[model samples]
Target chain A: MTQLRKALRPSTKALPEYTRGHNRSLVLQTLYRDGRRSRADIARETGLTRVTVSALVAELIAEGLLVELGQREETRPGKPATLLDLDRSAFVIVGLDLSEHSVFTGALLDLDGAISTRVEVELAGSTGDEALAKVVDLAEQLVAAATAPVLGIGVGSPGVVDLGGVVLSAPNLGWNGLPLQALLAERFGVPVVVANDANAAILAEHSFGGAASDAMLVKIGHGVGAGLLLGGTPLFGSRFAAGEIGHVVVGTDGGAVCACGKRGCLETWLSIPNLHARLDRPENADARERDVVLREAGERLGIALAPVVGALDLGEVILSGPTDLLDGALASATVETLRNRTMAEFHGSVTLRMTALGPDIVLRGAAVMVLSSRLGVS
Target chain B: MTQLRKALRPSTKALPEYTRGHNRSLVLQTLYRDGRRSRADIARETGLTRVTVSALVAELIAEGLLVELGQREETRPGKPATLLDLDRSAFVIVGLDLSEHSVFTGALLDLDGAISTRVEVELAGSTGDEALAKVVDLAEQLVAAATAPVLGIGVGSPGVVDLGGVVLSAPNLGWNGLPLQALLAERFGVPVVVANDANAAILAEHSFGGAASDAMLVKIGHGVGAGLLLGGTPLFGSRFAAGEIGHVVVGTDGGAVCACGKRGCLETWLSIPNLHARLDRPENADARERDVVLREAGERLGIALAPVVGALDLGEVILSGPTDLLDGALASATVETLRNRTMAEFHGSVTLRMTALGPDIVLRGAAVMVLSSRLGVS
Candidate 1:
């Protein structure tokens, strides 16, 4: 144990190959994080010489990964320098989301995370292999529509996904030990990243949504789950199931049993159908009545989440669901309950908001996976 | 919010000063992680050329940080090469733990995390500034005993500690906003790191103890708190207050109130005194009686920890407290409860163990902070 622990310690990079990769990653990551930069800016930010930066830039430009965006004229500099930016339209990323209740959705996203083409296939009561086939069919349609080279395919499924691109378990899709990444990579001839849908949403939030360094996203729909981002990276636990919060038992008084055999689980209270049932949907309920019902559900979620907020000292919690239900009284109720329950130091500070990205979150998040893994740019 | 998020983005290291610092830290980290290696081997491992590695090794040797450890026999195609290793006795680090009940203890730790000298000043009716003064006195004694140059001071204090070394509300010692890091650094003329005691202990486990990449350390004593490690690093939140789990509410039918104004908080159940009180200690108790009492307390703790396990999918939960009370039946009950309450996927997989370092965990963890921040080696 001692020797193994010692051997697993981290080391730095300095070898020529390592340096080249590191420098290349540095330039791309810099542009991704800080947006477009002039050659001098890239060199200065990366601690690389102008010659090395220029050489890397030329290679990237030749490869169609980077493009010149005119020049940034400086008043106090010797000469104006041309700026380099990611060629957003030169390549496409196919992103798939399998968290939806009855749809297998896929979209073609460019370097900027903008969805250029989207395709969907209804599950139509499909399950298991049939559903998997539907997802592949949708992805293929999206891929065919993309004019640029597809860099990779990223799938955000509902399950425990490992770094090796295997789905350890997806109860919704009845997938266990599925080499979905390998399958997609083989069929599409591109790199693939398969992550939990909630985790994917977290990456998307970090990439585009207003996520702080430490943030959590809770998606409430057919099933309730969460994605955790701690210290600027996704928190994939020992089993790559770090953000699997849906089945956690919330209260002691037994309510509806969850699929996992847990009573009063978070999912039982927050899942859309369960929520509607709990609310006792009145016939043709008005906005006021619906707001009142949704608010109660949100409070239940907040009570369930108090421990998570207090334990992790998280800065924010973004809720994703139907906008009308999640953003109005429901969000307010959640914020109020969370504030009253958590430590006073965090009161009114743990911001709770509806996700801004809507249904496109997981899809864009999948694209983020490809960009990060393939280009080291996130 | 847009500009703020952009400003918070981490940028690549640049400038000559930063580059030199990065390279030096990389070499030291390599030695710390990979252990003894020839300059050529280090060059290859670090992606640095032989010339660069040789020069760095020479500089390190002159600084008494690295020492040649004889030469390797001809086991390869080329000539046998000399080996370089960290000079374990080259420098000393002062580690202090402020989480103990009655004393402020400090120790002189070598590069290999061995305790060379230990000193303690009992907090005999001391409070506030007097208690802070006693800690300084103890550290001074330990630092003076070191024959080697003191590298830095690392302190693991109870309460909310910020990155700037300020103790933000430590109720036990009546400390609030005490600039302990600056105070220690100024007095010692060395770098100083002050972290939450639990966080420091997590670092210690990662450094010397057998800790998985994703692990949690729960310290139960005068107070109950946890430290979380995700993806091989401490999960410090936006405010550097992650893993403050003591105040999280545990049970549904509330038992007692916590200091944080929360009812049935984990602290009410898991704190050492609370646990013993709840057990109603029997006189001349048999092993069976003790096991029953301890098991009850352990079960309570498990109930409190179920949400955490489910949310994060943690692989291990380490308990640091009185081994006599924590091990045996209590540990089993906690394990059982945790397994039963958490997802079935984690059944029999979540390991629960007592700290290998015992009460010295936070102290060693303090050394880990110095190793990581000052040397980038942990």
Candidate 2:
């Protein structure tokens, strides 16, 4: 380590503390991405001195964060080194999703982001304190059911959530200026993270669903919203309302009024309830009529997104909603509309697809929030 | 420093090289933002050790990057300390703006972002190799005219420029996959950066125009384009087409044709030539009629930008264009349309105003590119 420091010292002055934290994250990230490895192997992969790797590995093991996975099979005469890996099953993460139209869902997620247990509570038109009570109850149930120690808790709620985990507003849940993270942390005596549902979903798509770093995930559930991942960081915006595209009017030709008292808002066209209302009308009984309805909704969505796509030069657009509603005609229309609205030579092949994570995307994303905050190894 | 490190050591481990670079930038930024300061003052402001600050200052002064002013005059001081500042006049940056319709402009800029010399060359319908040659010739003139050592060269061109400074496509200039940066660097023997004019404009706005770290600058020239600065970093999209919103179809009710073979594109409604064509029509003679035309054009711009504003929750939208066309009625209409089209509660007060930099925004932005890349300061 000293020799390495000397060699690099000509251009780079050494500041030991920052390097240690960065290297620690690098070590965990390496194991998280590439699986188990011997200390020597980790050192080689990470370009860290073998001594440093050994010390870090030992410290991690002592903290119960890593497990010795026994020796590796060797063809040579030298004794095989003991393998080490993250203790993935040692702790459970509590994740809650409050973006659902009818129920609040909670889950026990392992470090691997796989759900070990699931629970849900019907909202039953709850609001304000009642809604807060239900969220607490659901979290309590998930915490009680965790098979291992709780690592942390993360909530993906519908609204503008600030960096400090305050839900600034969620009209559906009647939340305003709610310090959700602080409340949960005080009650559970653990770290807590809270974010917008769409934001959480984008993180899950990036971490688990193989989405690219610069991708936008549009969440079209009870409300229409989007989450942007640019250059590997989620944009929270100046007002913590990044991806709040639900109420932005789409297209010049106005349509039905939105809940926000606006005409032709994206939500009026893309929200599940609105889409159902438009498609299920008695006058639109034929399959061709339904196709047209979905296609129009898709076109509206494209209109709302085309400027964003062009402005950001985004390459991927992931739709997170009921696959039945967003697939086929609607999805195809969105692609066609985007291609027509934007410059073909510049954004000719922007990919638009449905997320495979299903409704659990927010839940998994919540887990990622906890993992990233608690261990910095998501 | 050791005591501070010990206090922070429990959670943060040290990595010398990364912290050194970070601290170097911190020092430069502190002096850049706060003006001249003593070593003690810099240490206090940046939380860096006096030893570290002294070493960095000495190194910077030796490199001709920092200047030490006379000792501070203080009534209470027993011994006054010398003040340090960036050597703002020691280097000149060459900036080129190629987004103009009929002319290419160049300037020599000091560290304070002040232009000391300016020059231009008429396009005269030049394209392809001829245009490239003109750009080289202009750069040579600026380099020769510099009164100080040339730091680097930055070009803000009208095209989809890749991260490697290659012009992927600029139909107006008939450039396709031209290695602009490499060619200029080889000819000038200095670092060269080439980016889309809009991207460069945004950088200028952030560094010199007092724009926020997370803001968008719309450059309306011969063509319409935008540059985004999110979280203090310029966003280069997956295909380097970020901020290519010029050709996005603004309204479903199509009107005039665009050069991209699209009708009612934002360019048709907001570009210099298009706006002039619509407003300068002989039959539309009255001021009210002119207001109506400009207002309608502004509404179209709002329609194109509302989705982007909502998606990113941007707070500031600075327009770079002819003030006569974008100000007053047009600017007001754009703001009004945005309010009507978006969630008023969330984006009610988004500021949309013309940039104060005028036509020189792209040129200054080009200088910022070189400043930020070469010195990690802007």
Candidate 3:
């Protein structure tokens, strides 16, 4: 024992202080990914012992985060096994989706990932402080109405967000270097996560909606953006500004000028506002003519995305936001354009589908953020 | 006992059957990621028992793949510990880098990740089968010359590589749909991993070179590509072709045609060959000298990457491949261009540096692939 202590000194010195917490998080994450399990099963999966699993489970249950579900049937002739699962009502999380036109706030439930008590507030003007205040106010109301302890808040915003929670530049909102996360955290007295809106949408789709765990979620609303998910995790580029497909120059000469002082950006051709402007001609455009124009706009969106699809070889492409604008003819035209432009081998390998979350996708993603943070899974 | 048996039954029944070898591989992976430690440390880190770690270590040591060192000192007032590490001389891995113009074959050491031997073979005007045969022959010779047991071989080729090791395309090499992995594996009597050259380069940079645990590795060789690393894991887009930045259209019209049949691709404007063609015209009286031309080329490269830098918020960019051909005026021009084009707030946020491994970055990445696959770390 004395020799063991001496021998372990070097390793112990090198060991990070956060190892214990990380280990616990790993256990919780494994359980979360795999669902209910016995102590022995957890031990086997995590490479821990039954004793360690028992101790951890006990600690978790004591914290009201987990619950034992009594004996489960055994195949072998042995002692009955104890099953453990996350306590469904142990905690709740708040998810807020802040868009240029509207704000959505909701509660993401524990265990089952259901959204409860959701509210949508439209923005009169796209002011940073005004939008933030609306979000905070809605959050307070939701928290007051909550039956379970609220763990944290996750806000999905459009634009470049730093790790410090500062919105560096959101062209749509005209926000730059705003300490959004800090302000929200101070107000709510809980941890706050600020993510790119498209990234959050991707997370929502991957976790609960139609996008697979490895899909790329592209949101073509008032703007064009993308969120890349690999192995159930969002891929944040070095500066946390990955998946900005809007600014990827699609045309160099004589294309619509972008708000970012660039010409021929995908957003210039694919954005809802741009499409609407093109279709809403006061000169002589009927409603039926407008529908044809919108359908053509969708075809253009597909043409713009075809190169990206061929290059990335992504199997799933999910579209979200303003379904009325992207329905029927528009959807089919987009698919046809993609099919025509992509490689023959990848003809049917890619699936383009509308988001299944209706209007609550972004909000659900925000809730997922809070849940992920509380559970230390992300 | 009956209750315990009943409870355990479901878990036991539901648990997927995994082999002992797989568990052993997981143990090795944990050690590789967390570094050297005692059996207790391995068990603690991996959630396995000390007994299991001990057994695996013993087996590995007996197999000459691991070495047990003397006891290490303990930080806590407990038992001293035994230290175990991978034996550097136990095994050798062959890495191949198949670029457009040249083919580099090398043997990389285990544990320390040093290059044991290297042979650069320029691609002759030959058929695909001939080139493959030459690679196999070279690998055979390297394996025969090595003092250690050959664990595996890893090949980095320019193409879309499927899980089945098929090279979907290699326009430069004139190869398509080649079953490289299976052929190499069969010929060498060991596991072989075939991956995209850019992906391998990123992997090498992430695991053993400049990108660190979290960074995006952008390879600006004959074509522009990106490799994303988030939380020490590579982000393979849904179809395993996520980093095809070369095909990203950078101009709207009147640009050089890309091999993908697209006009104004980033690669068309930024690749070395393209730069040489654009700038090196002996007949043109007003054309700048070679030095000035290279600088301008670098500026164009930076311009092409500015949007990516802004969008991804990348911390640093590592420049690989023929530094002599890419350094001086071109490099400085690139830096200046990046600084000027990116948002002012993001100015100086990204640092550009030469790859640490020089031209061998791809080969090193291939070696990393073998290490990761065998250890199951990444």
Candidate 4:
């Protein structure tokens, strides 16, 4: 921080307008965290006055963000109080993931995080403008199919993203300095968020996958990258490129050359194609043989993750990619290696698991971004 | 997050009492961040009412927390405004660091982070109750020599500290579940904080070292550990053992055994003793040979940090140890290795530097913890 910037920065918080919005967010967040509750229950949980809760609840109901589901079924109550819940299906999120190498995928997800509609467009040869067009089209299709009003659009694209949602560079998509947020916001007439794919994945894990509020997600597919969440929020570094781990050099000297001109880079050792080449699995390889190969890959991944686990004392490490490649022996190897590499004390408390969100992890992550930015629930 | 806990937790913030204290803290923090300024200037920067600023300023002045620095020379102004600054010498802080092995040290620091009194006690054979007594004695001696009102006491010990400042365990100090906070608070009749030594170093780096708000501090002594900061806050994971990086295995298999029964833990490779053993500098060794040995140590350290940097997208790696061992060739090697291991693009922005605060880094860190916990400055 520079002296000039420090001089300009405010020490006191904002006024009542900001506080009011925060209070409103608290009410909505309470509803999301704790399901169906009476007005009195909400007031007690929120520490808001009865009158304040009632007013906010009324406003939320008027905005279709909440609904009264009649009286609760209490056995020994003189008068059953009315229960309020989030109007889960009243709004839908349009989520897109462009991380996949050959296709652009999208979906419409309800407030409950369930996908209601899905669409995709092949991008095997599409580049630059065409690829951007494909993403816009898929999102448009999902928006058109939504049964309720769309909340906003959230995108998980492959590349270095700026704070303002511009794609600084996406080598595979041949994009550089694209103002994706402005373009999509203008086209859809809704707020839009564009972030790195792995970052989106970690958000999904925190928002819905029951992963620890503070966790780490390592996505190993055509490329390897990580997403870090600390204290329930994504750790976007000073440059907003905090989780780009693919090109880390793992060896002291030459083994295989990387596109980044570094020898023995982690990408050369862990990416899907690299692993496949190293394994040399025959078409008829048995399960045991496959496990051995996966174990090797997983061990390498763990070696890479040892310092990270030790440095952050992270509690969870989520693997997201092909289940066939990451689960079973591979996942076990990664966990065991992490246990051996970092302190044994951290082994028991730290969790290692494949993502429960399955193959649509990035798409669901997009939905989580919308939830965080649009509704402030995440 | 469990459903029952979610239901039980209150969603709203504390009432006006907490808000009032927070506002006062904001005002003090503004003075600290922006240097000397007028009440009107503080009010404008903090977005607080002039009346509120006046009331808070008057309270602080009465409390001896602020002092009028007279009028500023302003050529463009018709009348010069009076300046207010932190009463740096009005209060003194007692800080203790237990990171050293054979000795325990304590110091008294003023508001400007400068030490005034120094004290130490030999712990060659001290352990358990005796060691605790020595610590208490050292603190009392420092307190007795203070020239002003003692603000509080802070301890940076080696252990897994709980939120309440209980030492879960500090093997070297032979402490376990020691209620240090309550004990010291009772003895001194003032606030006290006990945290892991690395965590304290990180707080110091954040509070006064001009380090980036989000950064890491690596202290290599008898043990190797790191302290992490994210978004201006220390990254204390659930176990409060977030920065314990000493036992991270640097080797895939056994080369040497660790005290913790792990083979080739990071401590085995990076501790000062281990580095000296590896270098084995003959009395007549040439400078080039010594450079090679230091370079190798630095490269090894960098390899260990590769995944951490990649996983966190960290751009700064600060090394704290004997300058003779950590700077020049060794620091360059670590920087080069980090550059090679992580993204080359990140290499341009990443920083690798020695501690500018010198050997008292942890002691100053103790003072930082006092400031943060006692006054909520961090």
Docking category of candidate 2: medium
lDDT per residue for candidate 4 within A1-378, as digits (tens), equals 132123223344422322545667788898888779999998898787888788778867867788999999989859999999988877788999899888888898887678878898999788899989998889889878977777888999887888788998888889989999889988987778999899999988887788786688999888888889887878888667687878876534355898788776767877888877766758427767777778876777787887777777788999998887678888898888888777765545678999989878888898888887766786
lDDT of 1 by residue, B1-378 (tens): 232223223344432222445667779989987677888788788776677778778777766778899988876687789988988877788999998878888999988788978988899868799998998898889877888777788999988899888998788898988999999888877778999999999989888889888888988897788898877878767776777777766656776877777687777777888877756666526767767778866887786677778777888999999987888888899889887766777434889998898888998999989888776787
In model 1 chain B, the worst 10-residue window by lDDT is B1-10
Off by over 4 Å in 2: A1-10, B1-12
User: lDDT ranking from best to worst?
Assistant: 2, 1, 4, 3
Residues B1-378 of candidate 3 have per-residue lDDT tens digits of 232122112221111223455557667777666656888878888766677677777766766666778888878787788888766666777888876466545665555467878776656765488877877877777777767666678888876777677887776777788899999888877778988888888888877775755455667777777666565766566666756666655433456777778566667766877776866577433535766767756766665566555445567767776677676777788778777555445445677777787777778888888887765554
Task: Using DockQ as the measure, name the better of candidate 2 and candidate 3.
Answer: 2
Q: Candidate 2 residues A261-292, lDDT tens each?
A: 98989988889998898888998889999999
DockQ of 4: 0.32
Candidate 2 lDDT score at position B317: 91
Interface RMSD values for all candidates: 9.8, 7.3, 11.5, 9.7
For lDDT, the strongest prediction is 2
lDDT by residue for model 4 (B1-378), tens: 132122223344422222555677789889876669999899999887888788878877866778999999998958899999987777788999887888999999987678878998999878888988998899999989987777788898887888899988788778888988888888887778888888888778777787886678889888887888887788887677787788877644455787899787767777899888767758427788878878877877888887777777776878888898888988898888777677876545788898788878888888888777656564
Cα lDDT over the full model 4: 0.80
- Give residue A219's lDDT in candidate 1 (0 to 100): 89
Superposed on the true chain A, the predicted chain A of model 4 yields a TM-score of: 0.91
Least accurate stretch of 10 residues (summed lDDT) in model 3 chain B?
A: B7-16
Q: For residue B69, what is the lDDT in candidate 4? A: 96
> lDDT by residue for model 2 over B1-378, one digit each (tens)?
232122123555554444676777788888887777999999999888899889888877777778999899888948998999988887889999999989999999988788889999999999999999999999999999987778889999998999999999999999999999999999987879999999999999998889987799888878888999998889999899999998999978887888779898898888888888877897666899999999998899899999998999999999999999899998999999988998887888899988989889999999999888777788
Question: DockQ of each model against the real complex?
Answer: 0.30, 0.50, 0.20, 0.32
lDDT of 3 at B336: 81
Each candidate's clash count = 5, 13, 43, 1
